[model samples]
Target: MAVSLKRTPLYQEHLSLGARMVPFAGWEMPLQYTGIIEEHHAVRREAGLFDISHMARIFVTGPAAFDLLQRTVTRDLSRVEIGQSAYALACNEEGGILDDLYVYHSGPEEYVVIGNAANRDRDFGWLAAQKRAGEPVEVIDRSDELGMVAFQGPKAPALLQSIVETDILSIPRHGCGYVDILGYRCFIGRTGYTGEDGFEVLVPVEGAVALWRRILNLDVRPCGLGARDTLRLEAALMLYGNDIDLTTNPYEAGLGWVVNLDKGPFIGRDVLAAIKARGASRRLVCFEMFERGDIARPGYPIYHDGREVGRVTSGGPSPTLGKNIGMGYVPVDLAVVGTRLDIKIRDRFGPAQVVRRPFYRSPSLGG
Candidate 1:
């Protein structure tokens, strides 16, 4: 017998909104409410809300919490200030990425690690196994007990400010703070996956539907996983399973900036150090079709000079740019901007060219 898929706290809310539910990471999630392109433009132009409760919220506490995390991720946790968040990657001993997550320093000796929905169990198990025989650190999985929602776009702050009593605009990028929303305590973070200015709100599972309904009353577009994927793709954000996996390393995925080799020892530090010294043979790059009508898709072969050089990892028609865009891995020498290539689609090859990172950038990002 097949195991039943999980449902988030807001599953009913999604159904009420006429969302087309589909299986994603072992859960029945909304693929689209209105439509992919319509929802995608809603986030880019105005504001949109997403049911992100599928993400894992794991908590670590005790005197040795910091030390345990220092040994588990690639970024240096010592530099992260209280109430601040940083993106980091957990890797295996061989330096292959296990998952990329956000770490928030909530308080002294208290931290929250938000892992990808699909990697929750594995991430929690990895952390639990690292507790030295009698260490004080505690790894607790709180994903099912809590709910998360993301409000994104240029007008997100204004919409959020109207609901909460806290001065949310005061929170800087990558910062987290506590606030009261309709009498419910919420953990709000100034971060998002859509490459826009937004906040990810975490609250008790019981309060999820209330919060979702309140946001819906504000005229915020209710987006689904389809738009979320497209928005992140146009932003050049790496997806865990597709863009990076056990066979891929941070250096080759264009995530070298997050690796801190000088911060002392951590999981995969030695191998990453060696890889950085030797240089990566291939790198992740963004590209766009030179001719219309040819769309790139995952697993499609990329060619240069009549030879297969790489394969597309994520690709789709960008609603914001109104063009076909995709990301893939290619030889380092041919990854430069302006380099022309071909993508095999069905019976013919379509012309494409390397472009700068991020096919779209919202004007509301820097403010």
Candidate 2:
């Protein structure tokens, strides 16, 4: 018998928008609303909204919360004060990535860990098991009780600021705080998967629809997984399963910046430290198709010279860049910018060149 799929609070809201539904990570999610390319451009030019309730929402609380998380993820928690969030990686003993986590220091002795949707059970179980016999910590899974939404794009701040009385723009990058969204108290973090200035809000399931509808009425286009993928790909942001997984390490995946070796010991610290002391053999690189209309897909073979050197992890047409771009793991020697390579598209090799990591950057990124 087939198992039943889960639905988010916005499931009916998505249907009302005539979204194309598809199965994703055991959840019935919207793949597209109008069109992938159209939605992608809408986010780049103005604003777009997404129901990200499928992602896992977990809370680690108690006096030992900080200590527990400190010994688990790669990012140092010393700098992450209350109202700030940080991107981190949890790894197994062998240094393989367990999951990429977004940790928010919500309050004193309290933290909210956002894990990948598919790894919710495993992540929670593993984290709870990591607590020592006397550790004062409680791991609570709130995925079913809460829903997530992402309002992304250049106009995201101004549009969101118009709704709530609080000044949303005051929150710096990676900062988070609770705000009243249409009178619903919700926690929002100034971070996003797409390389755009946006916020990810966590709200109670009961209030999700009201907030979603209110945002839609503000003229923000409802986006789907298709546009989300293309947007992140254009930014070269690594997707947990596609770009980084159990077989890939942080350094090899161009995520060395998130790893802090000078901090206290953590899970997989020794192995990761040793790897850093030496060097990673392979690195993830972004490449663009040399020919027009040649979109690369995941699992496609990458060739240097006449031999297959790597496999594409995440790839597709970058609507913002108006080109086909992809990311794959290749030897360090061949991952340099401007390196020419070929991607095996079905039966033929398509010419490609390793360009910079992000194929597109929002004009509002730095300034």
Candidate 3:
């Protein structure tokens, strides 16, 4: 039997907009509305709205909620204050990344953990299992009742400010606050995956359609997963299953900044500390194709001096850069900028050079 896919509250809205639907992470989501390249450029030049309710929103509350997060995730959540959010990774005991998520400190004893759709159940189970026999933490899966929408771009704030009563610009990067949108209570976070100034709004499921339609009235481009993937790749952001997974560690995936070895103790502290001391053998690097005919893709073999060194994790053509760019794991010695490598695409090898991560950066956001 074919497993039935789930749908967000905005499913009908997507259909009404003539979206091309496809199965992604057990959900029937819009792959594109207008077109991939057109939607991608819209977000880069103006503002684009995305239905991201497919992402999991798990709430952790109680007196021990902070303690629960401090032990499970790699980042030190104790330092996060109310209205602040941080990107973190949940790792297993062996220091392998399970999933990368965002934790928002909603209040003194409340936190909202936003995780990938594919890892929702696994992420919740991991946190629930880590609770001691009498721990006070309560892990609740509120994803079904909540709806998430990401409005991203350089003009995102201006667009959002016109809709909400609160001043959108007052919220700093990685900060979050509650505001009223069209008479509905919504939580807006100044965070996004596209490396642009934006907000991820969480509203009740019943209010999703209304909010989406209101944003649409502002002439915001409605983006889909196809454009989201390309935008994040251009920003060099890691996809959970693609760039980082059980076989990859944070240090090796170029996510060392999120790992706090000095913080008391966490699940992967010991192994991560050891890796930090010895250094990673292989490092993730971003590369741009020197030749234009072929585009690099995931699972393609990477070679240095005719020796198979690693494999591509994420690869595709960047809409903003108008060139083929990719990220792959390569030997530490060959991961430096300006290093030349060959990517085996099908029958032929293509010339590529390692460049800085975040292949594209918005001038408005600054370096």
Candidate 4:
């Protein structure tokens, strides 16, 4: 039987705005509100709001929270103090990533784990297994109780300051605070996926629509998944379902920097260490077409020396760069800057070259 997809509290508002809705990860989501480029620019130049309530939120609160998390995720949870967040991956025994997530230390013995919407069931099951094996943390799936809102762009801080009572301007990047909004305590984190300064707010689902209206009333345009996709692509941030999956390890996916083998024992530690020792064969790199015509896309063949070498994993037209940019796996020899190659787009191939990660850089983040 086909299960009915869920909708966020802002679904009616999206309809009122004539947003193009589509199914994404089993949710009736907004594909675009205004035009993709317009929404993209809104988030890049000013503030834009996103309804990311569909994303999974799990809480771990217990005396052994730190140690239990330490034994599970790739990053060391011990180093993350309260009010800070760290991005890490949950991997299986063989070093294959189950899902990539952010760990937010909410208190001394409390932490919230955020995961992709599609991986909620699988991730929860894995965490349950770990608990059964004597891992001392209590994992509670609180996905239904929370509503997540992302206010992003250059004007994000100012807009956020006007809504919530807290002084967000004083909060540094990656810093989080608790604020009262609509008579409820909200966990607000100054972090986002777009290559811009922003805040992600976790609030009670009951006040979600009111909060959404509050943001929209503040002149922050509503952005959809279409604009979100293009923005993240321009930033060269990896998407879980598109860029990497269960088979791809951090070493091969150009995310090796996030892996800390010296942080101590964790699942997939030995496998990652071995892969690091031997070095990776294929490396992920960003590239652009030399000419203007072809649109590079994922699964497109990459050619070097007239031979099939690699394949594109994520590609799209970047609104910020005003050009087609893509990321893919290529032989280590050809993954350097200025390495010329070709991208097979349908019946023809176009001139392309390998560049560096982050096709576009953010001056604020020192990218």
Provide TM-scores for the models.
Answer: 0.98, 0.98, 0.98, 0.97
**Per-candidate total of colliding backbone pairs:** 0, 0, 0, 0
Worst 10-residue lDDT window for candidate 1 reads 358-367
**Which residue pairs in candidate 4 collide?**
none
Whole-model lDDT values for every prediction: 0.92, 0.92, 0.93, 0.86
Error of 3 at 8 (Å): 0.7
**Worst ten in a row by lDDT for model 3:** 358-367
Expressed as tens digits, the lDDT of each residue in 1-367 for candidate 3 is 8889999999999999999999999999999998999999988999999999999899999999999999899998878999999999999989999999999998778899999999999998998888888988899999999899999998988999998776778889999978899998888899999878889999999999999999989999899999999999999999999999999999999999999888888998999999999999999999999877879999999999998999999999998998999999999999899999999999999999999987988864774
Candidate 1 segments exceeding 4 Å error: 1-3
- Across 139-256, the per-residue lDDT of candidate 1 in tens digits comes to 9999999999999988998899999987999888899977899899889899999989999999999899999899889999999999999999999998999999999999999999
Model 4, range 44-162, lDDT digits (tens) per residue? 88889999999889888888888767878888777789989988999888888889988899887888888999999888877666664665679899889989989999888887887
How should the candidates be ordered by lDDT, best one leading?
3, 1, 2, 4
Supply the TM-score for candidate 3. Answer: 0.98
RMSD of each: 1.1, 1.0, 0.9, 1.4
User: What stretches of model 4 exceed 4 Å from their correct place?
Assistant: 1-3, 132-136
The CA lDDT at 340 in model 2 is: 90
